[model samples]
Every structure is written in C-alpha cells, then in structure tokens.
Target: MDVFPLPLARIGIIGGGQLGRMMAKAAKRLGCTCVVLDPTPGSPASQVAGHQILGDYHDPSKLRELAEICDVITFDIEDIDTETLAQLEQEGHRFHPSPRVLALIQDKLTQKQAFAAAGIPTAPFVELSEPSPEAFAAFGYPLVQKARRGGYDGRGVSIVKTPEDYDAHLPVPSLLERFVPAAKELAVVVARARDGECRCYPVVEMCFRSGENVLDLLLAPANIPSSVAEAAVDLAVRTVEMLDGVGIFGVELFLTETGELLVNEVAPRTHNSGHHTIEANVTDQFEQHLRAVVGLPLGVTDQLSPAAMINLLGAPGRRGRPIIKGMAEALAIPGVCLHLYGKATSAPFRKMGHVTVLDPDIETAKRKAERVRDLIEISAEDHP
Candidate 1:
C-alpha cells in the first residue's frame, strides 16, 4: 500500500487537545509532520506537533492556511465549521473523514436522525427549543436533554427527572430522548482504512461517575456473555461502515436490562474509551488512526492483555495550575501506565489525564484501576 510517500506527508489537525496530542505522537512515529491549529498557545497537541498554527478553529483563513500545508487534514474535536472545510475540499484539500461527514454529525439531533436512517437502533428522541414543563411531558419523566450542538464530556446534557428540572435550566436548540435504562454502557473502537478495510477492538464496559455522565472507569473485554460482546462489536462496526470514513471511530453503546443493545453515540475520532488500547492492544488507537487516515494497512486489533482505564479529573475547589499528587504510589503498582495531558490549568471535571492498568484478567485489571484512581490526585494549585 502506497501511503503519501513517507517523510513528505504532513497531517493537519483542527483541535489541539489531548486526542490531537496523542495523534501527533503517532504521526511522529511514522515520520510525518503534524501541524496543529487551535487558539490556545502551547496547547496539548501544539506542544508536541511539528508546528503550530495559532488561530480560531472556525476561521476560514486559518483553515485555508492549514489545508495548504498538509497532505491530509483531520480533527481531534467534533465541533468545527464544515462550510469552510467543504470549500477547501472543493479546492483539492484532503480531509480524512471529509467535511460532509462532519456536516451530518455536528449536531446531536442530526446525528440521532442519521442513526435511524441507517437502520441503527437508538433511543427514542424528540427535538426541543424551549425548556418547558409541557415539553418534558411530551418525552416523559427521567428523559435526557442534550444540546443540539456544542457539548462534550458531561456538559450540555442533563437528566430531567421532573418537569421542574426543565424549568431549572435555560433551553437552547436541543433534543430530548427517552432515557434507556441501560444495564451497562458499552464502547468499541473501530478503524477504517481509506480503501475500506475495517477493524474493531473488543467491547468495553463503562462505569460513569455518580451525578455526572462522565466515564470513571472502563473495563475491556466486558465480563458478559461472549454472544453479547459479539453483538456489540457487530453493531459498532456497522455504524462505522455506514459513515464510511477513514480514521478511527468510537461507538458508544447501551446494553439494556432486557438484553438488547442500542447505539448511544458515535465519536468520529479516537476516543476516551480506547485509552486502554495504548497499553493493551497490538496497535493503539492513535497509531491505528494515523495508519488508516494516511492509507496504510489497518493494524491488528488483538489485545495483548486484559486492561482497565480510569480517567484523571481535576480535583474540585482547586482552581489554578495543575499539581499532581500520589504519583509514586500509583506507579508502584505492577503494569500501570499514566498519561498526562500537558494542560496549564485545571477545573472541576476537566480531563487532565488517564491511567491504564493491565492484568492477567479483566477483574484484576479493574480492581487495580480503582486503586490507581484513588492514588492519583489532580489537584488545582496556585500557579507558582
């Protein structure tokens, strides 16, 4: 397979967050220059990339400049201006997943609609423009309210248990969904080559933080019936193939109490769920994304060991530069790896880093992951 002739190939990434940072590392391994564009100076990805373009992501001029210099352009974040990307693509700039794909998914309502159109089963949903009691009645109690656009990592989403809950928050253009009483939240990471080759990792079970939708821990090879695991993977793969895009896709799923699986959402780039792949799989998601987007052969998705991952979130009430505590105790555990995103500041619930614990069995990995989570403290400290 002829990838864009090695050392000459340059990749441009739209958002320079942790995902982009990891992708840049993978590009470096392949001897490709990664150019990151974001407003923040010395952002996570920009710090590691070959070069940085400091500008707003939605600025057409910056977009054009990025496209002009890179052989392939991709995004670390889902939110982007598709119109500018489309215009650039028309002028022969290459986007791995294509701006058209972004146009279809940039909004929550549109994304859910696409799932239905593709014959993928998802939770029942309705569009909303106002936060009203009647509107909540339409979807019924204990529903989910998700902003139609621009929400991530437990923000812009709320569980409305009562009609009063609707009145409590201001409304934007959003979608309300009948909450699925899922027994388990599942995720699968799949990579598709430009030539249509597809590969997927094993299903993972997600545990969310209480009172928040953020994932706290991920257990790979979810301790479920093999048949259920197969079904989850099949559903995830189908979702990616329907989108028909290069690069890696993370498919979030819900396993219901009655033994049915439903698609929760699809992230069109490398995801938090796949962080364990860095230590547990033959090829990590970042490298797999680089390989696929650049037209290299898809790598093996086989797991090297059972792994569990826990996200490192910033400690509440500490609002300044990040000061990590308990690193020595966390690392002293056997088969543990930590990854810190070089962010200068910290806030409540912000993702600062993640740790992956590997073990001979999934249960052991999960137990170790819990200890790692408690041992490491991402406390916000006064900048010195």
Candidate 2:
C-alpha cells in the first residue's frame, strides 16, 4: 500500500527505552505523533516524545489510557500484560502484531516449540519445570538455561558448563537446550507488511563480549562465505514467515562448525542487532517498523554501506551521571555516527549509546568501529 496520504495519528509506545525512542523518531519522520507510557520519569523515549504517561506496562489502567487517545499501540517490551492487551483489542483498540502473537512468544519454551512445529531448524530444547539431578543428567553437562519470561539483554540466560553449576545456575522453571558450539552468531532483521509481504536485511555477525552474553560488535553483511550468508537469510525469512508477524522481527541464528544454521532466538520488536541499519541501510529498522505497523508498504532492506556498530556500555565500576569521554577522538574518524540514549544514570554494563562506522568494506568498518570503541569510555562520577 502506498503511504502518500499518511495519517497524522498518534502512535502509542508501551516502553520508553532506546528502541521506543528511535521508533518515535521514525513516526515523527512520517508526520505522526508519539506518546510514551513508561514508569521512568524521563525515559529515553519520553525525552523525545511529545507526551508521556507515567505508569507500569503491566497496569491495565495505563493500557486503557494509552489506547484511549492513540490510534494504534505498540510495545517495546516483551513482558507487557498480554491479557490486558487482548481485552483492549476486543474493546476496539488496535495493536500491531496482536496479543496472540505476544502470547505465543512470551514464553521461551513455547517459542521453541512453535519453531519445531513449523519445521524450522533449531537446537534441541526441553522444558525443565524443576531442576533435578535426573533432569540435569538428561540434558547433559554444558547446557543452556533461559528464563521462560521477562528475559532480555543477557539477563535471563545462563550457561551450565559443569555438573556443579547444574542446580546453582538453573532458574526455578526454565528452558534447557544443548549448548551450541557456534562458529559464528549471525542475525537478520526482516520486516513483514500486514499483507504478508516480507523483506530481509543482509545477515549480520554479532561478536559477544568475553564471557558475557552482551554483544560488543554487530557487523552487517557478515564476513562469511556466500552460501553461509544465504543460509542465514533463508532461515530468518522462514522463521518470520512461520509467525503471524506484522512488523519488524529480528531472527538470531547460530552458525555451527559444520556451517549449519540454527535458530537462536527471535525478537518481535526492533532489536539491538539491527542498530547499524540507521546509518547503513536504505530503510532503518525503526522506520520499517513504523511502515509495517501503519499498514504501509515495507521499505527496501538494502544495505547502503558496509557498517559495524559497537555498543557503548557503562564502565563496570562506575555509577552516577553518565559522562562520555574522548568524544573528539571518536568523532575525528570519518563516517562515524554516534547515538546516545538519553539515560541519566549509569551502571555496570548498561547500554548508554552506540556508534556506527560505515566504510567501503566490512574490514575497514570493523577497524574504525574498534577505534571508536576504545577512544570513548562510558564513565560516571559522583553527583546528585
């Protein structure tokens, strides 16, 4: 559908994090107003939004309030009260991706089951209602445990590498799967229109921090063989096609030593793995999400440049007002674009901002991104 006569409707966002912030900006670019509902007084999205409602995402009253004035609502958080959203939808409030989609994806175990039912390639996994010696033994050592709900940004995942950690690291009720000895972790961001037309970005390679699940570098058009990249894209497209997705979806995959691609996870909203799209792609993920939600034709997912992105996490020991050091040095490098989330406080490993480095080649972009990562330090000092 053509969006020439786009409505100036109000877009309601449930969580006011950086993703919401960027999405709001994209909405504004298309002449739409954005309202945020978040508990944080001055969240990242609220800083940019025209109006904000201070309330919890799970509160039914807040959900109603957001639906009352907004044309359509979307959530940045996966933990929103789906029952409430369903009720609101029944009451004539519109929501992109729908409550049913959220219900299916809210649980890690169920998501994996869906992948299996759809005949998608994914790692073997099982639900562990309660961790036991027998259950641990069945899963074997060196397994992965993930919280069924409320997990994001490396918070609800653990790697049990030995028998000693089986009981200690296991969550109360979690999903256990065989640990993947991945040769590379790749991702593809795909946008699906309401009519089911889909387009996917080139595969991206994510480099995690040492011994941490957090991503340090996200490189686009993953430096891999053509066949591997094609496999990653195919898996991603198939994964999204299997879902009732009407917006942007992030499909994360693990490329094994034998070059087999397996689904790792999926994010319904705009994801960290696609942040470089803002500077490198013809249509950024944020704008693509807006297009998909607004019933407009999906934008081209073509890569405009070879790019690499580095997340600027707060210093491990620092906590206070955030102070970004060595900005001049980082900005001095050409083709560098820095984006700082308007977060007031800093904590260990907290995502404060990110920089995207674009160059003629992936190797050059990676090198430039490394320089920006080292030059700038996310630190904080004592303050009120």
- Candidate 2 local lDDT, 1-384, one digit each (tens): 544555567899999999999998898888888999999999999999869999999999998999999998987889999999999999999898788888888888999999999999889999989877778788897888888988888878888888887655754788889999999999999898889898898999999997557999999889899988887888888888888778888899999998899999998889999999998999999999988897877888889899999999999999999998999999999999999999999999999999999999889999999999989999998886
* TM-score of each prediction: 0.97, 0.97
Residue 202: error of model 2 in Å? 0.7
Q: In candidate 2, where is summed lDDT lowest over 10 consecutive residues?
A: 1-10
Decoy 1 TM-score against native: 0.97
Error of 2 at 5 (Å): 6.4
For candidate 2, list the clashing residue pairs, or say none: none
Q: List the residue pairs that clash in candidate 1.
A: none
Estimate the overall C-alpha local distance difference test score of candidate 2: 0.89
